[model samples]
Target: MTIRMIGRHIREGLKNMWRNGWMSFASVSAVAITLLILGAAMVVALNAEQLSTYVTGELEINVYLNQQVTDAQGQQVAREIDQLSGVKSVQYISKEEGFKRLKKMVGTQYASFMESVNSGNTLPVQLVVKAANPRETTKVAAEILSVPSVHNIQDGENVLGKLFSFLNAVRDVGLAFVIALIITAMFLISNTIRLAIFSRRREIEIMKLVGATNWFIRWPFVWEGILIGVLGAAIPFAIIAYGYQFLYHYSGGAFVALSFPLMKAGLVAHKIGGILFGIGIIIGLWGGIMSVRRFLRI
Candidate 1:
C-alpha cells in the first residue's frame, strides 16, 4: 500500500473509533480486563519457575572417604570424581575441617562432647560433589560410591526426590492455568470485537456497495482492534511493573531468608512487559481479522 493509502486507513480507523465511542470503550475495556488477568498469572508462573531453578541448583552430594585414606589418596579421589560425567565440582574436606564444622553446628552445648570423641577425629574425610544437573544427582552419587576408598555417600536422596517432584508438579499446574486463561481471554476479545463490528454492519455494507475493495473496508476495523489491544495492554503492563517494583523494595530481604531470592523488578518488568504487549497485539489482530472475515463473508 502507498503511504497515502496507509494514512487514509489510519485516519478512517481513528474516525470510526471516535464515531462509535461507546462500542470502542466496551471493546477496549474487555481487552484490558482480560490482559490484566493474564499479566498477573504470567508474573506468578515466572517467579515459581525461577524459584524451582534456584533450589535445584543448590542441591549437592557428599561422598565420605574411609578414615584410613591419606591426603594424597583423598586428592586423587577428588580428581577422579571431578572427571565423572555429571559432577560439576568436587571439594575435598579434611576430617579436621569436618570436625570443626560439626562442632560449630552442634554449638557450645556439644563442643565438649565432640572434643571427647576418643581424643582422635572419628569423622571421615569427604568429597563434596555438586552435580551439573540436579536430576542426575542420584546417578552421580551411585557412581561415586564405586570409587576406591569411598566408604559412603550422603546425597539427601529422599528429600531431593520429593522436592523435585513437587517443583515439577507446580510447574505443570501453573502452565495449565496460564493456557486456560489465555484461551478465555481470546474468546472474550473475539466476542467483543464481533459485537463492535455488528454495530457497524451498515457502514461496512455501504463501503462494499461502492468501488471499495474488501481489504480497504477491513483495514480500518483491524486497526481499531489493534488500537484497543494496545490500549488494554498498556494499563496492565504499567500496573504490574509498578506493583512488582513496590513489592521488591518493601520485601526487606524476607525472601533471602527463605533461600529464594526475588528476581530484580526491572528485569522482570522488561521481560513480562514485552510478553504482555506481544500477546495483546496478537489477540487484537487475530480477533479483528476473524471477526471481519466472519461478518463480511469476503
Candidate 2:
C-alpha cells in the first residue's frame, strides 16, 4: 500500500512479463479477445435499447370513421374525438384526402377503384390521435370508437406491441450473450494469468518466504489485467463506431423518415460505445482478481 511497495510490485509485474514471456503474452491475449467480444455485444445491446425507446415514444393511435357517416358527420366525429381525454392532437383526413392518398398509392389504374369506393359509400375519414403514453392508446381508441358515425378503430397498438416485444427479445438475447462471453473471458483470462503466475511460482514462494504480504503480490497482476483489457477494447470500439457512423449516413435517415425516432443510428452507436468501455474495465478487473486468487491460495 505504500508508494515504495506499490512501485516495487509494478516493477516486478513488468519484469515478470519478460521473465515468463510466453505465459504473460497468453494472459494479455486472452484478455484482449474477451474484451473485444464483450465490447461488440455491448454496442449492439445499446443500439437496440435506443431504437426501442424511440419506437415507444412515437407510437400513435389511428381512428377510422364509419363508411355510412356523411362528410359532415365525420368532421363532427373528428371534432369530438379531439376533445376526448388523453388525446394530444387529432389530425382529420377527409374522404378527399383519403382518395388522394389512395391515388398516390395505387396509381392511375386504381383511380377507377377509388371513384367506385368513394362514390356513394363514404371513405371513412382517418383520425390520427397522439397519446402521451402507449398504454393510453387503447383507452383513447375505445373512446374514439364510441363516437357516433365512427364505425371501426385501427390503432397501431398491435403492431407497436409486437415491435416492442421483438425489441425486448433482442435485449434479452444481447444481455445473455454478453453475460456468457464475459464469463468465458473471465475463465480464459484467469487461466492465462494463472499460467503466468505458475511460471513464477518459485519466485512467489521466495517472496512469501521473505515476508512479502499477499497484497504486494496481487496489485501488480491486477494492474496488468486492467491494462490488457483497456488496450484490447480500443481497436474494436473504434471499428464499431465507424461502422455505426457509416450506417447512420447510408440507411438511418431514410429509415427514420418513415418510422419515428427509432432509427437515430448515430446516437445509438455513441451510447453503445460508452457502455462497452465500462464493461471492458469490469471484465478486466475480474480476470485480474481471479488470476491472483489461484496464486494467492498457493
User: Which one is best on TM-score?
Assistant: 2
Error of 2 at 34 (Å): 4.6
lDDT of 2 by residue, 46-141 (tens): 555665667657767777777767678877877787788888888888878887787789988778877776765456778788876766778888
Candidate 1: lDDT of 187?
61
Note the Cα lDDT for every prediction shown: 0.78, 0.69
Q: What would you estimate as the lDDT of candidate 1?
A: 0.78
Candidate 1's error at 62, in angstroms? 0.7
Tens digits of lDDT, candidate 1, 1-298: 9999888987876776777777767666766776777777677666766766776788788888998987788888899889989899998898788888888888998777877882687778888899998878889899999988999988887875686688678667766765675565566556655665677788878887887898998897787778777887898899898998888888952375575777788887888888888878887788778777876676
Clash counts for the predictions, in order: 0, 1
Which candidate has the highest lDDT of all? 1
Which ten residues in a row are the worst by lDDT in model 1?
Answer: 252-261
TM, every model: 0.72, 0.81
Which residue runs does candidate 2 get wrong by more than 4 Å?
Answer: 1-8, 14-41, 108-122, 132-134, 252-270
